[model samples]
Target: MVERVTATEETLQLLDKLKTIHGELMFHQSGGCCDGSSPMCYPRGEFRVGDSDIYLGDIGDTPFYMSKDQYEYWKHTQLIIDVVDGRGGMFSVEGPEGKRFLTRSRVFTEEERRELSIS
Candidate 1:
């Protein structure tokens, strides 16, 4: 009986993009500090998807559902939503468009490497 939670305009747009690429997405928080702390579209086991949850959308043309914990996390989010694309690429969200979910992970960005000077 689980249904997809309320999706904002921006969230829907992002979802559409993933659908086009036939990608899989996961949302998660590294449990860090800073506004919009959680990262979205995380590429790996960031959120831990399972087969027990009721999937609602298509990831890579495959529908997926969330675990109980995942649903809870989305229910209480305040800043952003974590997402992992079908291709296993991780990403985070921000701004008024995606400010409904609370972020938990440390902020992730392509710029992170530049800050850390990591290749």
Candidate 2:
């Protein structure tokens, strides 16, 4: 059986704010520069699942998942969020310590978060 993971305080707040403004939120972790770790959040239907996907289950009406590879790399780290509001953006968590290789990231801004009661 697949193990279930609960969202963290930062992540849960971000999800709630996203839901209020964007209807539903989805999560994805893919390889990229800067230690090859990146986390993303967009409207529920905005993400496309790749072939090697690991299902992370639903957050209310939001369906969340990650690539099997991403799950393996980040299952043990803290989660952060990055929120985008049109051209404005904010990070839910940041700094050198919170940022690193194989680290969990979810960039969301304080303004966007507070505007949505997420911060």
Number of the top-ranking candidate, with TM-score as the measure: 2
Q: State the lDDT of candidate 1 residue by residue for 1-110, as single tens digits.
A: 22232344555566666545545554443344444433344433445655545343443332334445444444322233343223221243222233333333333344
Relative to the unseen true structure, what is the Cα RMSD of model 1?
14.6
Which residue runs of candidate 1 sit more than 4 Å off their true CA positions?
A: 1-6, 43-119
**Per-residue alpha-carbon lDDT of candidate 2 for residues 40-73, written as tens digits (9 for 90 to 100):** 5566666678789877665444555677765565
What TM-score does candidate 2 get on C-alpha atoms? 0.49
What TM-score, over all chains together, does every model reach? Answer: 0.33, 0.49
Give the range where candidate 1 is weakest over 10 consecutive residues by summed lDDT.
Answer: 87-96
Q: Which regions of candidate 2 deviate over 4 angstroms?
A: 1-4, 32-36, 59-61, 72-119
